[model samples]
Target: MQQSNAYIITFSIILTVILGLLLSGTSQVLGPLQRKAEELDTRKQILGAVVDGETLRKMKANEVLEYYQNRISSIVVDIEGNKIETAPDGSPMVAEKVNVGKNYKMPAEKRVFPVFIYHAEGNPDAVESYILPVYGAGLWDEIWGYVALKTDLNTIAGVTFAHKGETPGLGARITSSDVQARYQGKEIFDETGTLQAVAMQKGEGKDYDADKHKVDGMSGATITANGVNNMVKNYLQYYSAFLEKTKSAKSSDVVALN
Candidate 1:
């Protein structure tokens, strides 16, 4: 016997409801783990500044977390370089708790930036380098990555860039090792101490270190190249306040020792 239209309608409705409920339940069950995975991926990207990609990709999840928790030191600071230990509401402010994706939504002055200090291999207390999270507009969408600075804070050790939807083999080349390698040994400050963040002009890096502010730009991706230049310059200026303060303190200690 064929079912009536009424019966079919009722069955369809019930089936839809059951599937909806099941999907919702599954999402709820997997939500925490999904978020945890995403956070670890972000950590991996941040670690790209110091750790090579090949090693990062081969590491296990718990190993990555253990390495980050032990070898890395994180701190949150305002745009002015002041460390923030308490939120305005009196709650604890922790660097690991900062959501940089969300924090980017805030205004420039209100933004809370996170700095990751990667300690030396055998010295947990000595910072081998500093990593700063950087984000900005790209030719097609948002671009971001981590920039690592040497202990002097003037030399750029390395950079790792990623984009939302940049064209493959073109703008996406920003993530390529060949492109990122152009930043190595480049200084962000001039001899006179003025901030001169690296510039990406095609083929200009043959003269690398000549200007102290230039890097080899990606071929055939001028817009993305300009975006990178601005991203580095603006973010470097924002982080400079903090580096200057730290540099001054170190100078004072040396003076006392002398």
Candidate 2:
């Protein structure tokens, strides 16, 4: 078989084009499913902040999505605590579209905040909890989590932390039930009603004044603990407007009744 260099080059070019097209087609076909899975996983993580691990383990993807849709009501707000449906130019203010990682790099004044309110069954107005998203630097890379606050907005109801590359036996311990449980009943506000983001004190937490906003840090993860401390505080400040507004309304109601 005698083939000129030009002929060989043409054949190779055709084969390359065909392979590229096939890959593109495959990606087109699978893209939606992959995105669907990712969505379900995110919903699961958000649910993890509220539901128990065992209960979540028994649920399927559709169930997770349904749980999110039914139990969670959400809003998108800017740094100033004003509700935004779209940008100042009138686009849809999609809560799910904001990327915290990207927003983190932007100036604080330019960041958009998303708030998720979970309501108990059959209670439309009675908010079960307020779930806040938080992320920041860990010892190695980035770490993030969801923290659910009681209606009082000061007491922590539940917390779920995850990290990109924290130390397994130390920093990564934040994900442990025992570690997170320490946050339960901890207040994020001081006696004077000031927002005092919860701190992670070194030790067994027995030394920490939990009622006054302190949690025990991971055994040997001081830096990671500090990251969590800052993360929670940052989010607390971001959410202050909504929290304070609700707190004031409830307090006013009590005064009227008395």
Candidate 3:
């Protein structure tokens, strides 16, 4: 009987070791593929922020990269309007010092690649806009997205939100098409030029004075939607300087050449 018991215990130990080995090997093999999937998803979100209507449906990962390559000019600028680096090839680079605020010097390859998309057949001297990336925590997990602004830098051209985990039908609505559409053409600032991040309120008819810069919150999804609003407002503050510089540069070009 004791010999039989000993055999059972040994078998259990071997099984556990085998399972562990299998899991570890699987993780190693799938890591690169998983990363590729994430990169593709990010590219899709960035493209989605800029396009409208059926154009979004037609966009694929390769198409996104191609469009960005043809239209977007990437540059790394300091908090003070000085150019730290510029990618002549327009290849996207990982933003390493993103969270370091505006104090640190962004490395040549580590700078945030701000994609500037020009309006089709629009004024050649017009400063179209820029899309900036934002990432932060939500109630259940991490959320990330892009916010595109007009040349005025006070208006929202478009926005796209995505999350790692959230309760479906509740917090996950942050990324829903209906929810994202609400932000389109929304002004981030008021007529007086004050930055007022739109909020997520509950129930009907909240006072969103046109001069105050506010939007109606998502019904039944207040917390998650508020998370979206806060993330945009906070991160955008960091780019205020960069926005001003871009506007000035565009103005100078308009005056000198045109």
Candidate 4:
């Protein structure tokens, strides 16, 4: 009986060590591939947000590479609106800000990819808009997305919301086509130049048109939607100087090229 007990203990130890080795090896082998997959998924979401249904369906990593190569220009900008450096073509670059409490423990230089999609036209004045990257914390996890606005930087052209995890049918409403569509063509700034963060207020009694920059808050998910509203306002405030610069450039007919 003592020998049997000893054999069982030995077997348990051996199994534990074997499992540990297998897990470590598997993680090492799959880490790069996992990262690559995430990168591709992010690209897909960004492209889907900007492109139409047909165009987005046709988009692949190689196609996205070509599109970015031909039209987009990427540059890293610091918190103070100073341009840091132009990133390498076709490489994913990180934003200069980090959200620590939201599980992004990485340094500012390591979190969030800031990609700029430039609209190219035969006539320099016909260029469309600039897309800015924004991210922040939701109730349960990290929320991230791209917001494309017109050249004026006052009107939103499109937005895409993605989250790590949030209550289904509640916070998840942020990613719904209907919810996201509400942000399309919404004004980001009032004529008085005040930034009114969009809200998901309850009831239809509130007048959004009168408010100019207001949006109807998501029903049943007020808190999560409010989180989104705050994120947009705060993140955009950080880029105010950059937006001002871009607006100023528009007045002076400065055209960015790839």
Candidate 5:
């Protein structure tokens, strides 16, 4: 039996409306859950810079959140490194909630950078390390990470990285534990007091001297490595003012003690 054109058209329209409503209802039900999962993963990555990846992986979701809440403190700063409590629209700015990828699209001077301070366990007053977020272009998509610095603010204590799309064995290795460990104990400043960000040289299997500001290059991932180098260098430069101010305050304290 052949259906009338009007009947077919009405049926199609009704089906489309039903499908749209179903999708909207699903989104409403899952939206908060999805957001919570993303927030948890972000916290994990940020903490990974200072803590062991294995430790993070072993913990439950609530444990991770508890650890972050107890030990981590953060602040948002502009390119000039001045603390910014309110966003451009006058809303309160939360450091953990700042989207680095979105900020990367805006002009550098207009972007707000988030700095995470890892406090000593059970002692919030004592500072342990500082973690800075970095983002940049990768070979196929975007890459980003958190870099933790020691008390001096020049030594890289640890790092944790992730990418949107990269080759499995090549560029994707940026997230590998071995690759991240290479940055441990690396110095970001030279003896001349200049901020010379640590770099990943070209090619792999080449040893770099410990005293130099370079790390082992990744095999078949030169572009990704370069992106990491540039991202770290640029973000460090952006955060230099805050670093300098912190250093000055430490110096003043030392003088007062003397």
Candidate 6:
């Protein structure tokens, strides 16, 4: 039996409409869950810079959120290192909400940097570390990370890196624990107080143990290594003013104690 052309067209249109409605309904139902998951992931990444990944992986999502809420406080600073309570457009500024990737597209002077402060477990007044977020271009795409500095504001406590796209087992190793561990305790400032930032040298299997500003390079991933080096150097430079201010305040405190 041959179907009439009008009947076939109407049937096709109804089917298309039904499928569209189903997709729309699914999106509406899952939207909040998806957003919640992304928020959790972001918090995890930020915490990963201060806490070890092994420990983070062992905890549940709610546990992670609770830990973050209890241990971390944050502030936003401009290019000049002034603490900003509001954004340029008069909106309240939240450190965790600042999009570093979006700020990367804006002019440097117009950008706001977010600083995450990790507090000692029992003492809120005692700051254990300051975690700064950095974003930059990788060999294949965008890369970013959180770098935690010790109380001295010079030594790296830990780092957590991520990327949009990169070759598997090559440049992608930037997220590996071994690679991140290499940055621990590395100094970003020289003896003269000049910000040197940490650098990942070419190749691997060399002893950078004695050097305060050098880390082991990724094997066969020179471009990615260079990207990491530049990202660290550039973001450190961007945060130099804030770092110096913090160092000065610490020195004053020491002097007062003496």
Q: Top lDDT: which candidate number?
A: 6
Candidates sorted by TM-score, best first: 5, 6, 1, 2, 4, 3
Per-residue alpha-carbon lDDT of model 2 for 117-207, expressed as tens digits? 8897656577889888887998998988889998888888888888889999999998777788777778888889888988888755465
Ordered from best to worst lDDT, the candidate numbers read 6, 5, 1, 2, 4, 3
CA RMSD, predictions in order? 3.2, 3.9, 5.2, 5.2, 2.2, 2.6
Superposed on all Cα atoms, model 4 deviates from the true structure by an RMSD in Å of: 5.2
TM-score of 4: 0.76
lDDT of 2 at 248: 87
Tell me the deviation in Å of residue 255 in model 1.
Answer: 2.1
Clashes of each: 0, 3, 0, 4, 0, 0
Q: Runs in model 3 with CA error above 4 Å?
A: 1-9, 77-82, 86-127, 204-212
Q: lDDT of candidate 4? A: 0.66
Model 2 worst lDDT run, 10 consecutive residues: 203-212
Question: How accurate locally, in lDDT, is each candidate?
Answer: 0.86, 0.82, 0.65, 0.66, 0.92, 0.93
- Per-candidate TM vs. native? 0.85, 0.81, 0.76, 0.76, 0.91, 0.90
* Candidate 6 backbone overlaps, count: 0
- How much is 30 displaced in model 6, in angstroms? 2.5
Candidate 5's error at 229, in angstroms?
Answer: 1.3
Model 1 misplaced regions, further than 4 Å: 1-26, 121-124, 203-211
Instruction: Tell me the tens digit of each residue's lDDT in model 4 across 113-210.
Output: 35365567333335576667777878898887777777788888777788879789978878776677667777777768776645556643354655
Candidate with more favorable, higher lDDT: 1 or 6: 6
Local error of candidate 4 at residue 201 (angstroms): 2.7
TM-score of model number 6: 0.90
Off by over 4 Å in 6: 1-25
Tens-digit lDDT track of model 5 for 23-47? 9999999999999999999999999
